[model samples]
Target: MLDANLKQQLQGLLTNLREPIELVSSLGDDAKSVELASLLDDIAALSDKVSVTRADDDARRPSFLIRRASDAQVAVRFAGIPMGHEFTSLVLALLQVGGHPPKVAPEVLEQVAALDGDYHFETYFSLSCQNCPDIVQALNLMSVVNPRITHTAIDGGLFQAEVEDRKIMAVPTIFLNGETFGQGRMELEQILAKLDSGAEAKAAEKIAAKDAFDVLVVGGGPAGAAAAIYAARKGIRVGLAAERFGGQVLDTMGIENFISVQHTEGPKLVAQLEQHVKDYDVDIMNLQRAEKLIPAKTEGGLHEVKLASGASLKARTVILSTGARWRQLGVPGEDEYRNKGVAYCPHCDGPLYKGKRVAVIGGGNSGVEAAIDLAGLVAHVTLIEFDSELRADAVLQRKLASLPNVKIITSALTTEVLGDGEKVMGLSYKDRNKDELHQIELEGVFVQIGLVPNTEWLKDSVTLSRHGEIEVDHRGETSQAGIFAAGDCTTVPYKQIVIAMGEGSKAALSAFDYMIRLPADVEAEAA
Candidate 1:
């Protein structure tokens, strides 16, 4: 059932539809057919221009053929139920088909229209993945702008066989012509560049050669970007390698505690970070991950950093700033309901559940904080913790206690996320003390257990904590000489953006100090 608030928003969005849309469905006996039919009917009732039709063909049973009433060619086809965050994609698609064009740059549209060969893009995604929508929308808009390109957004859970055949382990995995093209949140320009030239294969093939720099910064998060900028300011050759530039910040939604601007979103902040780094002369390498770190043979020797792309880079000094990722709840229906109702980020997807009930899984500072933050936006918040008592600080616990709409349940182990095939509706848990099972009817679940640092690759080269985080000193210097570490990936206690940036600056300065004191022979060679 659509809430009054969501219904009103949908009404306003669909009110200006310029053309009639036909939702063709062939799922006669499928369970999802009823949900899809009901949703389409609701949408149709909102506007005089929207309608639904039953298709006789069984081959396209579960597919949605969204097109203009007067046009013979289908504008778009949704293969599965577009619920959860994907609901927004359906709305955008309808708007585009109803005479609204996407806000893509004109130059990008020109490049897209000039493409010749047939390009079929299949993007597999989970509803919970915050990064998937942008990639899906970009490719979808490309399909709308050029007839030569056709794209399909597939829900990974619904199509397990295809996901297995492709060996997809992550969300936002893009397949071009049945082969893996790219993965994770990518820019349209990067996608076009890869297609224009077989860059992916080329990158793998040209790895024997090594690129050298004075300072090498790993990870592309706040810490890495800060380190790169600091190093660049020293007028030395600096290199940055990142799997994705924004790190975990890309999945964040509303950041009220970042200081200064009061409030900003994750993607928006990442754009500023990227632009700030680009403003400097740093050698930025995106979509590249560090696989191994090899120490130099002699003092002040060039250390080698191997990449997953088979390429290697040499640097006199290195700073490790690879950040951490959110931990997941390994419960049943959790993966299936991801994005539909199972979310890991409250700030990013909290507004979607306005006036609806949701759950926060965890009793730590992050979980309690999420509960307190969500209470203002959501109708009700149920915080479930596995421990008997909340582990958050006293201050946060007090804040959470003051919230009337928030309920904290301790010693409860979440067993599964309860959901229909299309969306999450509730969750089940087991009471540890009573040995009884319980259920809570809710629309969304936010998992705030903790974070896992990205330091698996550095375990062999640097001293690591028992939890797999890199070990570093007060000056950001790691166990190894000429190597420093910072950010959430290190032994640093805090994981805030400001702290990471300050540590990054300190690490870059330490690297500079090491460089200046190098042996005269090594100094000459570096010069």
Candidate 2:
């Protein structure tokens, strides 16, 4: 199951093991079980400190536990083959269990160890999900730190019955003590904040004590990272407060269009951007959501930005790059059936609807791509587009046409989601051709319409367009002089990563120029 190149890499990584660890597997004679056993054997062959044993103790077949030989309480379980996006999680579990320290911060390690409650976490994940590995790895790290906190990462693709029973249509859904905990992509700080309420108040106090920055970048997407890095390189006090450090890019999958890089994944690029930013002197604050933007009361004065955690930051010039979020279908039952049957990420949640009929709402690149991807896994894919024709590229349209299981409907708008107070049953649409309503029976609905700018918080602060995007000039300056905006949240077109980065750098430079041109008295007072 493991290739030679990968085995060589794993062998090098396993050399970091300071202590012995055992892989206790509960497998059967099934094909998947045999594959899992083969993988376990290959892993054990790399290092003498690693060993594998069979003991069908877990109710979930083909499951395994990575337990520290010296400390049995420290264990993390995986209920299926941890390949695809989850391969990283598996490797992390091995190194962590083998006494290699995790990459988490020290304070977070303390917080994990200090937790007192019994948290039996079961995370339902899909192998193709780009966001599931973070949740799995975070929980695994917590389990290794606090024995009371145990985690089991279950592959929803393998346990189809359990997924159906739980009405789970999304990836990375977590259950704590048999109750729903959270869904979607979550970082370590976000997870810690949920379990440790005091952590928020503590973080707020720490943020409140910080001095005013010369340049403060709000949002932590590509634009925000670029802005922060550019400002920091100018030898100024730069601070970045982000709701989540990768932002929407974390949910993205393939990235073939990013310039110079040839091809890469979203998370991988975000990591490099973050590392580059960290190489500078920027003060980074993660998991900090901006609730309100209080522009500078006067010219050349500090602009105060308030956060959701009762913390406020003051900066001479602020760069808004909060970016955008997935646009939702406003139809009835859509919100109610979210995660139950309605999902937005086809790459992440496609496997959950294996052999099931589904509908893709939209005809753009994302929508058609989703239909094409889903056609291979689901029984049927009905693509409904609001436009008269598909707006996807010719190549994509050709590929979509080649798929035999896909059906396209043009000039139709999704009217309502049909559900039986549980999961999705079908959807109601309006046919422009006949001026009549239509309904299609399907088990799931994947909405890939597009994205909306994350500028709701700036509605009362800055000049916003009719579509809620921040109105910006050519210099990346917003309506306010000292405040600027960039990326998908601004008036920038294309909404590509490269464009965001360039705009971010321009906004930083503009802010610097604005700062230098301040009144002499204001400059002296600011100094």
Q: What number of backbone clashes does candidate 2 have, counting pairs of residues 3 or more apart or in separate chains?
A: 0
- Cα RMSD, model 2: 0.9
Model 1, stretches more than 4 Å misplaced?
1-133, 140-147, 150-184, 189-197, 205-210, 330-341, 347-358, 372-381, 391-406, 415-430, 434-444, 525-527
Off by over 4 Å in 2: none
In candidate 2, what are the lDDT values of residues 280-307, reduced to their tens digit? 9999999899999998878988899999
Candidate 1 per-residue lDDT, tens place, 1-527, comes to 46678778888998767777787766756777677677777777778888888775535446666777877353677767777767788888888777676766687788778878988888887665567777887787777777677787887756666655665545677888888788767877678767666555455455445467899999999999999999999999998989889898898766888878799867778889989998999888777888999988777888899888778888999999999998889999998987677877675456556677999999998899889888987899999999999999999999999989999899999999998886788999999999999999998899999999999888889999999998998899988999999899998898888888889999999999999998899888755
For residue 382, give model 1's deviation from the true position in Å: 2.8
Point to the candidate with the largest lDDT: 2
Model 1 error, position 418 (Å) = 6.4
TM-score of each: 0.66, 0.99
lDDT of each: 0.82, 0.94
Scored by TM-score, the top model is 2
